[model samples]
Target: MKVAALDLGSNSFLCLIVEGDKSGIKKVLSDQVKVVRLGQGVDKTGSFHPDALKRAKECLTEFKKEIDRHNVDRILAMATSAARDAKNGSELFKIGEDIGIPIEIIPGSDEARITFAGSTEGNLKGDENVIVIDVGGGSTEFIVGNRSKLHFAKSLDVGCVRMTEKFITAQPLSESEKQAVENSVDIALDSILSEVQKYPATDVLAVAGTPSAIAAAEIGKFDAEKVHGFILDQGKLQKWCDILASTSVQEKIEKYKIESGRADVLFVGATILHRFLLKMNKPAMKVSIKGVRYGVALEVLRR
Candidate 1:
């Protein structure tokens, strides 16, 4: 069967088409990433901006045509943090309905499970302890499990875009700002950390853009073969944070190749990643390219 998976995320909207098989699946058509910032200023307002909603609706409308062209067996579309918390979340759903694609809002635990499924396909050992973290635009999912079972799973309300809008003010932010964001990440992880210790995993699997960007940066400067699942050292991450904090937004855009829109929040994202590693006591983490989209594709295979 062919399936179309739409991920309505806080930072970006993604549509993936896949062909299901007994072994796994194959990507057929995957195109277009509309960075609509759907969760714009959601941290302060507790709701999605009206403009963000309209832009998201517009993007989904165009995606529907592509889905039809692919002639997929079914459409499995889901919304993440923003849609789950926004005051007008229902309104966004209604807009999706208007476009003929009904969106499913997934809870954090479920999100964590799906992310685990995607990450462990080739990386996890049958008996090893592993933690899979998905850093989305609006929330981050942390799951501890192995090949056979999920010991712990949770979702935190900390994400790159959310942190950017909330804690970052200046282009690169000051030293105090970096410390403030780090402290906030520690505070945010407190409740989740209490649960994480109960299931203590050995290997940490980091997912989503922030980790991916760090991996890319490492690869761009180093060797790609030595890069995948590379342990992100706290010292390196801290250095990046300090550098980002000291630089201007334009500097980040030019130096790091970060999207102009995302440059403002890159420091927060980088800081959050580093702090998470410190709290987990894991030295190195494997970066996974597969994440929610792969999970969405896997859902079709299971069906």
Candidate 2:
């Protein structure tokens, strides 16, 4: 069956159509993403903004058209942090109904599980401890497991969009502001580090926007084939993190060709992953393009 999985992230929304069966994804049919900022202002307001809702309606309408083009057999659409936190998150249900694709708001723990499944789909060794770190717009899910069995899964409220909205104010962040962001992340991570480190992950996998943008910057361009399965060196990752903290948003766009929405929160997102590594004492993480949407598709197809 050809299934389409939609990840309605706080920072962006995506639709991925693929042909797959019980074993695993067999072939990719289409993949599309748009940085819609659905979580815009939700951190402070605790509700969806009018402008963000409008953008979501428009973006989802377009995605529906794309889904129709492929004649997908099923659509597994769902929302994350933004929708989960918003008081008017039910708005997504109406929008989904209007688009003829119902959407579900999944819990953070579930996000971690699916991300682990999707990111490590074919890469897992039955006995090796694996940790899949998925940094979305409003939250970051740290999932530690082995052989598809989850041992520790926690979602922290430290994400690119959430952090930038709450802490970042200017381009080329001031030292004080940079420290503030890291400090907050460290504090949140402190709660999970003890339990996460107990697993001693042999493979650390990173999914979602931050890693994708970083991989693109590392390769000097956006090439999916090159970005997927990309590995990060601790030194190089920290170097880029420093460079981003001291750089302007436009420079990121001009140099790496990332979308504006992503450019705004790229540094914060990278910092989350950086702090995760530091806190866990992990050297590096392998990047995976497959994330929530991929996991959603896998579940739908396998069913």
Please report, in order, the local distance difference test score of every candidate based on alpha carbons: 0.77, 0.87
How high is each candidate's TM-score? 0.89, 0.96
Off by over 4 Å in 2: none
Best by TM-score: 2
Kindly list the per-residue Cα lDDT of model 1 for residues 1-303, writing each as its tens digit. 888877788987878788877567765576455677899988789888999998998899899999998988888778888887788888888888888887898665577677787667668766887888877788878888887888888778788888877777776576676777788788989878878888767778786666766666655542335555677778878777777788898877677766665667667777777888888776767776667877777876886
Q: Worst 10-residue stretch by lDDT in candidate 1?
A: 219-228
Model 1, position 143, has a per-residue lDDT of 85
TM-score of 1: 0.89
Weakest ten-residue segment in model 2 by summed lDDT:
105-114
Which has the greatest lDDT? 2
Q: Which stretches of candidate 1 lie over 4 Å from their true place?
A: 221-231
Candidates in order: C-alpha RMSD to true structure: 2.6, 1.3
